[model samples]
Target: MTATTAPAPSRLQRVAALAGAETRLLLRNRTAVVNSLLLPLFLVAFVPVAGLGGDGPLGPRLVVTAFAVTLVFLTYHNLVTTYVARREELVLQRMRSGELTPGEVLLGTAVPTLLVTLAQVVLVLAGTAVIGEWSAPTDVVLPLVALLGGMLLMTLLAAASTSFTRTAESAQITTLPLVVLASITSGIVVPLTAFPEQVAQVVRLTPIEPVVELARLGLAGQTWDGRSVDWAAAPQPLLVLAAWIAVAAAVAPRVFRWAPRR
Candidate 1:
């Protein structure tokens, strides 16, 4: 007798199942929980005290910096640890043996962290709107592109970083260079304008630079020189982000390891 073949799970079903499992795993890691969720809020609280640069009220700039910090800690840093831990545990290797494709495995693993980053950004924006008296973004599309593109790039970066991370504990060290560089250069705490012309020009080429520029342009509606912008101003930062994404996407597949390092 011929046996009937069960229909394969749809992409959504597959990703959702993987994401749900990842969520549960993420919840169990208290350090990751606090760092990814609570740490960003704590950092955002200091934006007013830190005094963001520019000609506008602090609300829009706060939103911009908050997005930067959130993507750094919540998405990039957390995923670095997650990838390392899963690799050390053979979780990635096992996932590859299943019905999941490589892209599915990576996206599923990142979904939990990405969702947390999104929630934290929303919370920060809400708090800023109420307390800082902020208004809606002048151009919503730029901010969305920044956040989504940042998440995708950060996820790819995390996976690529795992090539050097020997253990979950070492992820902290492996991730520090980018974390520190991005925090300082990505216009999170310091505006790119604070640097000299040549320095700022170099910083603009960094992976995180475009995300910050897009955030500022979208939320504050102003460029570094305090000039208001429209959709025309969006292309420069958008292209930078696209370039970074393409580089990361290309590098990740080449560097990403499905098995743990010896």
Candidate 2:
């Protein structure tokens, strides 16, 4: 008798399988669902209510800020905590025993969250336009580019953050820096254009700056003349975001544990 072996699945096939499974699992979690959807809506609704103003440039700023907050809190932070939880629970370990690679696992885990984020973005834009009287994009391409880049950078940062997370519970605390910074400096809570020259310059160095700036420009045709909001003037944010992604990609595989470190 001749020995036989099955051919390995292609990367796309593996990713699809894993992503589908992950999506199903994510949907089952009520907390995840609420945070992913409800929180953004709350932010979008509440910010304007809190006297953030709804006319002129302030209107678009509030909308963009709300969107950024939603992205960071619901998508990025939530995913990290969930990833760590899954890892500690050995869900990742069991999956690794199969044909899935680490990249496949991460991609699979992130797919559902990404979908939720995209949906949230759409809803926010639509809702703001209807209720908050927001306008259309000034430069559609810029916002799309920023959002895509932001998602990529944030995903990698979440993966990197997981290295410090010993347990799912700890992930809540671990993700605070990004959450706080996103709110404070990413033009989410406050516009960079409104800041003093020195203060805005400092804020521009953060990872979330580029995305928020691009978003503002896209939504309201706003840009900074002092190199803070000017995308060309501050390439460091992009480079820093890229560097984090590269380092996370390099280190996550080696350090990532699929099960609790007993």
Candidate 3:
């Protein structure tokens, strides 16, 4: 009898194997553990003290704020550091020589971060439901869109950021500008309604703003001023998210470096 060659792994198996390895590496890094898991949870607890300080349902606003901040820390910030570290260590370049495609490599690296963010979001939402007495969302699709779109956008942005990020340590400094800006302008620290109308309009166009707005809209059935809006309004923020994702996706591949920056 002739021996047969082993079949290549399917795409799902390849991605899963990569993700499993990435998850183990993430757990081994204590700093990443604190930043990804502990810091976001701490921020959620701090939100009530900071206060939403405006009209509309407090529960949804609090929940959305938690969700947005979690995404920033777990998805965007973590991925930037991971990408930079992997590049500097030549892991990315070596992986490219294997059977995994570039997209598969990125998706695998991102899966752990995305899963962590999702878990934290669920915990925050559940806690808010019990403690804040929040109700079910009026429209689930918008918030779902917000979350899924935010993940894709943040992932692409993280990859794009690796273009300029010289070292893993520098990622902390480089990520701060966007993180601070998003916290302020994305209605996490303060509601968009707190800003003057002209300023809010311009701020709404910022990358993370649409995600926050959609979460607020879907969960509270209210806009910035706490006015009720219908399904027709969903398309606006959704389109904005798509636009940002498009821009980032286009730019990331063009600028991304497979090797560490010299």
User: What lDDT does each candidate get?
Assistant: 0.83, 0.72, 0.83
Model 3, clash count?
0
After superposition, the stretches of candidate 1 with alpha carbons farther than 4 Å from their true spots are 1-3, 34-37, 53-55
Instruction: After the best TM-score superposition of candidate 1, give how far the Cα of residue 220 lies from its true spot, in angstroms.
Output: 1.0
Over 4 Å off, model 3: 34-44
Highest lDDT, which number?
1
TM-score of each: 0.93, 0.83, 0.93
Looking at model 1, residue 81 earns an lDDT score of 87
Local accuracy of candidate 2 as per-residue lDDT tens digits, 64-179: 66557656886688678878988888888898888888778888888888888788777777666667567666767767767777777777778778888898788789999888
Name the better of 2 and 3 by TM-score. Answer: 3
lDDT for 201 in candidate 2 is 84
Residue 37, candidate 2: Cα error in Å is: 3.3
Candidate 2 to truth, TM: 0.83
